[model samples]
Target: MRHQTYGKLAVLAFALVLVSFVILGFTRAIVGFRTARLLAAPTTLLAASLVCLLFVRGLLAWSGLRPLE
Candidate 1:
């Protein structure tokens, strides 16, 4: 159950990140980056958080550890 929950959460996060990246790219191109810069801080934080999550996932898999166990 925990594994399934984790998988679902990971998938949802991936989808949201993908959508945000697309939107950010389009907005920067059409609406200019000066406006986009207003979004930079939150976006950077999210990106860093995602990267950290990915790193932790990789580390767990490499160590053969089950998060709930």
Candidate 2:
């Protein structure tokens, strides 16, 4: 049961990151490419995706799922 909290926290963090990614994407769409050009970089979005995925994997571990097994 101790790990459940960490698992939940990880999931919550992942959700937050996901929300931020969406918000950034939305802003990029609305603001146009003339300004805020950095948002257009694929790396920014890719990094967010990677972090979220890592959190998801960690969440699984914290929830007691053996990843390699």
- Itemize residue pairs with steric clashes in candidate 2: none
Note the residue pairs that clash in candidate 1.
Answer: none
lDDT of 1 by residue, 1-69 (tens): 256765775676676667667767877987888776555546556766876776687578668784533
Q: Count of backbone clashes for each model?
A: 0, 0
Model 1 — TM-score against the truth? 0.54
Best by lDDT: 1
Best by TM-score: 1
Candidate 1 global Cα RMSD: 3.2
The lDDT values for all models are 0.66, 0.61
Candidate 1 wrong stretches, greater than 4 Å: 40-44, 61-69
- Residue 12 in candidate 1, Cα distance off native in Å: 2.2
Residue range with the least summed lDDT across 10 consecutive positions in model 1 = 36-45
Worst 10 contiguous positions by lDDT, candidate 2: 34-43
